[model samples]
Target chain A: MLNIENIDVNYGAIRALVQVSLEVNEGEIVALIGANGAGKSTTLRSISGLVKPQSGKIIFEGKEIHNFPPHKVVEIGISQVPEGRRVFPLMTVLENLELGAFSRKDRAGIKEDINNIFLRFPRLEERKQQPAGTLSGGEQQMLAIGRALMSRPKLLLMDEPSMGLAPMLVQEIFNIVKEINQTGTTILLVEQNARMALSIANRAYVLETGSLAMSGSAKELAENEEVQKAYLGH
Target chain B: MLSNFFVQLMNGIALGSTYALIALGYTMVYGIILLINFAHGEIFMSGAFVGLILVTVFHVHIIIAFLGAMLFCMIMGVIIEKIAYKPLRRSTRLAALISAIGVSIFLSNLANLIFGANPTSYPPTKEILFPVKSFELFAGAQVTNLQILIIATSAILMIILQYFIKNTRIGKAMRATSQDYDTAALMGINVNKIISYTFAIGSSLAAAGGVLVGIYFGVVKYNMGTLVGLKAFTAAVLGGIGSIPGAMFGGIALGIGEMFAVAIGLSSYRDAIAFGILIIVLLVKPTGLFGTEIQKKV
Candidate 1:
């Protein structure tokens, strides 16, 4: 489980996130939905240690990790599939995946996990030697997810896993996210696609501007009049 | 005339190998951090001085001195980076560049203070190391043992460097970091450490080039890095600033071009010819020969 308490993040003169808080229970998919500049990605980045919170604390399984650097955050079992699927363009898919487990030392375990990832995504195996940049948008998204999974993370933070994908591919990526959560890893997903995100999430939080606007069970949030009109395009 | 041309070609290669070595440092550091590291030349100068001291004062073996110079410069490069460039990481590129120039001036002046303005010559190769002997290559063309040694050693070092970059885990991490620094950190790569390793490797290569240059030319001076550093920087840019293979090709090509300039009775314009090529490359193909086209992230 993870807990974020009243975290504030700013980018110079702009307050990207203000007093925002969220949590993810073990073995659950938690969705944070917001529009552009709604601080969703900022929230994920703060938790991943890419950006520092000006105030408050982030407790992952009871330890405050707000000040840890990005690499240290990954070392502590939190891996992020960054926004826009920033895979290394020049590196082969296999190399990208290998670097995902950069902090791990278990050679045998790493190898086995890579094989397992290949099994789960056969397209990846077929193009393992190809550079990740050359992959299709959908495939790059898959590679990004696969790369994050390589860290063997306890908490996987995904930022816009479905951005810029075909509708069908978006469905496939969300299905993969659901499948991944079913296998025991906790996921904190940030998405502008509220409908799809709410469909798969166990709990959901809606962010407006830089603060939490609403929070409830995924079903309640999906069916709520305000949530539907504002986020679900109902 | 043909034999003379062949001999010049060999000499050019020996000279170019040193340029390639130094150019690698420029290209690698720029690839990772996008900093030109103007102080890189000073690092080369320091490496030559270190090698000179090891050989003369400490009386170490030539091989040991070579390795020691590399080690010393490796540390020196990292230190310079930490002191001069690292603090300016978040600042403008101009800031870091200015910092680099400052380090360069400080280093060259420090060397001037210690070694004085006089150019120090290495002991005669016959007395301290091995006898210089010329061996015929083919068709009346002759190559010296020193030339062969320089070419062989540079080739070996380059091969090892290529292998290290292409095959090793740290090397892969380095490539990834160069491609995407923040994303690399998301994968748990300590990018700071990677940058340090880059500085170390690049500095070592520059050191090797420095020592080889000193041995070949038999003289090391405080300001030797100025013109040579600019030339190596030219080589890096000419080869494509961030491209590894391009740096090698550019260095050798520039070297041969200079030798040819000399061969054609334009020795005074040799430096001019090198810079002219750089300007032409910049105007014609700014990315250099092997540079990747910049992509807009969607």
Candidate 2:
């Protein structure tokens, strides 16, 4: 549902993304894998409109969305769970979720969805009244996903959701990602954890220093010897 | 002797109330926009002069005129934010600070042209709405009609303000916006609208304080804002610059401290004490009593 074509992003003198292109179709989890500073995050950021590209276009569904601001991007049914799980530390867990649905007017449905999120992640429900900042790293990651899900986005762009979690929590998150895909919500995920990401993704792109270096089915990429040696630590 | 202390206490409350009112504006504006509106004092002064003209020359009802002055000041505040602030929202806070000072100078000098330098006495008044019914809250205190009015009006205003901030949907948006601008925007909250709302609320409070001062002291001047605004700023800082309730505590504390300092035969040190208390508060409780300690990373 999201198409990006030859996007270029810069931070003043530094070129972050150079002529990069990617796409995530409906009901698919597309993974962008790269090392630190490989432009994976920048690509997602450009798509979300947090970082406007100097060149090229972003099409959500069928409309060009390169000009929209980050908030307006959310309104257009693309929600981003920013890197670092930037949940409002002072707000209650519930408040963070309420903020997730900020662009929607569907009050009762939003409320029901929130309840389902709590049910889906029982730990969050137990600490619902607590400030989000106080949650454990795993719980905070769950909170971040829950918050993103609040918007009921057509496409959820997750940036490194598995960055700092334990192995079991990482698996749990990937399981939830699959469950989310089963519910028909498309996701564009950027990750440094290529092994886990490829395991769950149907299709994947290897982003190397701001440009797409490789693209194939997740199984083929995982089986590729060079990919196995470099990304999978085999 | 006890009556003298009572008199001092009454003066403290009156002075404190004014400080509280202005400080509320400071806190509110600062909280939402993360701005230090140096022009706020001038806004208060401008409101006073506006009220003065309405009452003396325009012959408007004291009540409706009060509303009119506040509304006028509120609009001015919004306009100032639109002109001086909205454009500079993404710029550094220092730039916003300088722009605020520029607006302050503009408003004050404009008032100087309109009202002139001489102090204008609020046309002699027989009390229509006394701020409070004069009574002995305690046996030894002597509360005048004016002091009572100042205390009552301030208390009522504060209560109304508290209710607005705590229970309203707009208030929730304000708190959310104050916490995080980008995040608040992502949540479909219009950040600019909320910032303008903050300016409106703050300016109205200053207008109310200006009118109350006129009714209490029986004189309003173009320069009255300098002293009151500075004290209110001091209170805002003392309480915790971006904290809502901290401003109240700081304002009242500054007021009582100022009055007590003068009462103790240290009238020469009035300004000194206000500034000193502020310095001490900053050095000690930088967050102010009610301010959040979390340093919000923008």
TM-score of chain B of each: 0.98, 0.94
User: Global lDDT of each model?
Assistant: 0.92, 0.84
> What would the TM-scores of all predictions be?
0.98, 0.91
Native-referenced DockQ of model 2 = 0.50
Largest lDDT belongs to which candidate? 1
Which candidate tops TM-score? 1
DockQ of each: 0.92, 0.50
The candidate 1 chain B region of ten consecutive residues with least summed lDDT is: B289-298
Lowest summed lDDT across 10 adjacent residues in model 2 chain A is found at A42-51
Q: Which stretches of model 1 miss by more than 4 angstroms?
A: B296-298
Model 1, position B3, has a per-residue lDDT of 94
